[model samples]
Target: MPGSSLALLISPRHKVIHHDGREVPDPTKNKAVMKELGKWWALLKDKRFFLLVPVMVGFNWNGTYLGIYLTRYFSVRARALGALSSGVAATAANIVWGYVYDIKAISRPTLAKSTWVIFSVIMLTLFSW
Candidate 1:
């Protein structure tokens, strides 16, 4: 449900009619629709489009856990620094992975499987420490 809010943010509205078919959207509404369409169009043109959502989800999940671990296992100052460092690391990793996906045309399944393997390895290492 992490990305579920996207539906609310970008969902299209539909009109229902009794007898006749639904009328076309108002010009004002069409403007908003066109703007949203343009944004999507731009995204599609970008090479990194395929990686955006997955990287976002991965970063969010890892970031939340990193913050929690820092709070529980370290001093307040250390936790703060850890959080900052983790944020930078996650951002960099996301960008690199995105580039890899774009340049290599990696499939989603392969990306997902690799993500799990990497996450598991990281988790095991962190837990052992």
Candidate 2:
């Protein structure tokens, strides 16, 4: 996989040491499918995971609809442009949101709630229109 290859190229193969003189074990050292599945199950049991399901579904539904609309209604050139623009816009949004989420001025919970409110307002506006 590209991700594994990139990790191999970039990550240190030896033990990781923190500035506070603590040694951290490499996460990639041990590989167990059953253990991974157990961790996945634990995550699935979390209330946050259940809450995130609908949000993910809505985002995926909109993305699929947008893709279908572009392919069905636009010419090849137009569709290509649309796809490129969509990718660029998504990338830009991710970068902007990453910085916004990392702001030290606001509390994490406050930031999370504000983001949810903004998301809900946007969704409502789009769907209502």
TM-score of each candidate structure, all chains considered together: 0.38, 0.78
* Per-model RMSD to reference: 13.9, 3.0
Q: Could you tell me which residue pairs clash in candidate 2?
A: none
Candidate 1 on 1-129: residue-level lDDT in tens? 879877777535454343577655654645677889999999899975664555556657766877787778899888878768877987999899788767656787788778767765665565566
Off by over 4 Å in 2: 1-24
lDDT of 2 by residue, 3-108 (tens): 7777665647355667698766767778888999999999999987775665677678778888898888899999889889989999999999999988999999
Off by over 4 Å in 1: 1-69, 105-112, 120-129
lDDT computed for candidate 1 = 0.71
Worst 10 residues of 1 by lDDT: 10-19
